[model samples]
Target: MKHLKIIALLLRNSLMSHLEYRFSFIMWSITSILWIMLTLISIEFIFGHVNSIAGWTKNQMLLIATVFGIFSSIMWMFFLPSAINITKLVRKGTLDFYLLKPIGNRFLLSTNQFSLDNFPRACILVLIMFGLIDSMGLKISFLSWIQFILFLLIGLGIFYNIFFTAAVTSIWFIDIFNLEDLYANILNVGRLPTHIFEGFTKLSFMFILPVMFVATFPAQILLGTADITMAITGLVILIQDLRGKSMNFLGFSH
Candidate 1:
């Protein structure tokens, strides 16, 4: 409960800060919607020439894109802003501010710069998802719905582990060269069906990049095609990172 209250306070303060700059918030909404549309267009154009890629029809592809959008907004809302910018703090030696705080540094670093704009962006994605579901006539069961949400959270955890690792690496490297680009490339793979890759490519993504579990595996769970191995792997990856990093899941150790 104490942690929850702290997170809530952080969110409230960040929202207040965002409210002070309404223009940035408005511009972000526009760009976010446009980005989603562009993603749809690119997927549709590819489908126009081929019936399906890796057995995913146009509707399935759209669903994947929607999941990707929601996940992107979630990162933007919290992780993206903080994780990407930590390099700046590392370089400037200002991380002591967070370290000196009474609370956990990991929580402070990750949630310190919450962007409220993505809240509405996530809502817009939900509306789009419902419209897509209605058009496709997908008969998702109550249990599948629950699994979808469960796996989504699981996927988010795995994603944070990978992304948090990247931020930690920045502290050591000091020249984190194209950190955002690295994450974006990995995130892009999740929007596509995992089966689309073969041999080395597939192994690299499934294990090394790990975005396959982050986005594709959860969508597969909802589609009734995901395997249990990937589920276990995701859990193990999260636990392994927590143990290896700092014996604490937050990455920074003092």
Candidate 2:
């Protein structure tokens, strides 16, 4: 309860700070809306000719885009900045500030800061996604909804572990900016459907890097293309990865 209140207070303060800079906030919101619109337009253009791209209709692709945007927004607003900076903090020995805190270290690291500026973009993406789905009269079953949520949770879990593992390694490297971008590129590969790729490329994305979790699996659920077994496998893998020890093999283990 106390922690929830603290989080609520932090969120409130952050939102208030944004409102204090009303014009900047509004401008940022408008820019994000325009960007999402342009992206949706591009997807439409690609699927305009073919009835389906790799068995996914335009609406199915839009769902994937929405899931991508939502997850990506969450990462952008919270995880990326903090994870990237943790490398510098570790190098400088300033991580002691976080370690000294009387709370869970990983949770502290995860939610120490929240960015109000990114919420507008996430909200817009969700609105667009839901609006499109609803317009199509796509009957989303309870089971499918559950699978979508489950895959989304697992996807984020995988994403966090991968990033955490990378950032922990950067404690020794010191120059991690480029490495972070490479990780982003891996996630970007899944911004579209895995069906579009063939043979080795599909296999690599699906298993080797597991970037397919970022959008592909959840998109399948939303499009009624996912089976129960696949969703269960994803959730199981995510849980196992979460429980496994994070090894900083590249960097000196701290």
Candidate 3:
């Protein structure tokens, strides 16, 4: 209960900070929208030349874009901020400040900061996704909705483990700033359906790198195209990876 209150206070303070700088906040929001629009327009240009990319229809692709946006916004909302804080805290050896606090290290690190800008963008993308789905007349069942939510949770779990592991690794490699962009780049690959790639590349993304968890599997669930066996396998592999990586991080931290 105390931790919840602390997180709530932090979120309120973060959003209020943005309101304190209205023009910059507004301009930043606008910039974000324009970039999203540009991506959509580029998709439009591509479809102008062909009926579809890979096996995905235009409406399906739009849904993929929507799913991608959800994943991206999540990164910005929680994972990005926490990973960044950990990196800086580790590098400056300022992590001890939080350690000395009453809060648990994980709790303090996870809820220390957030960018309120991402919340509105996530809501907008969700609204746009539903609107696009409506326009496309995609018939989604109740079961599919359940699957979508489940897979989304699984993806977020994978996302946290992946980026948090990277941040922990920075304790040993303090000078590398590019590790910051690593998560974002991985998320970018999720902007398209996995079917678009063939042979080894697709397998690498789906299993080895597991970028598919960030967007593809959830998108498949939303679109009612999910393969249950594959989805279950993905979740299992992620769980195993999480178990293994937790030990790896503990090994490094201690």
* Tens-digit lDDT string for candidate 1 (127-157): 9888888898767889888877887786676
| Collision pairs in model 3 | none
CA-lDDT, candidates in order? 0.77, 0.75, 0.79
lDDT string, candidate 3, 136-187, tens digits: 8878899888888787877787777777777777777885767667877888
Off by over 4 Å in 2: 91-93, 247-254
Off by more than 4 A, model 1:
246-254
lDDT of 2 by residue, 1-254 (tens): 86777678767876888899999989988988887888889998987777888888888788888888888887767677667767768878888797778776665665566677888999988898789789878889998888787777777777777787777666667774676686678778778888788899886666556777888888777777776675567556656655544543432232
Residue-level error in angstroms, candidate 2, position 219? 2.0
| TM-score for candidate 1, residues paired by index | 0.89
Could you tell me the TM-score of candidate 2? 0.85
Each candidate structure's TM-score, on Cα atoms with residue i matched to residue i, is 0.89, 0.85, 0.92
* Strongest candidate by TM-score: 3
Order the candidates by lDDT, highest first: 3, 1, 2
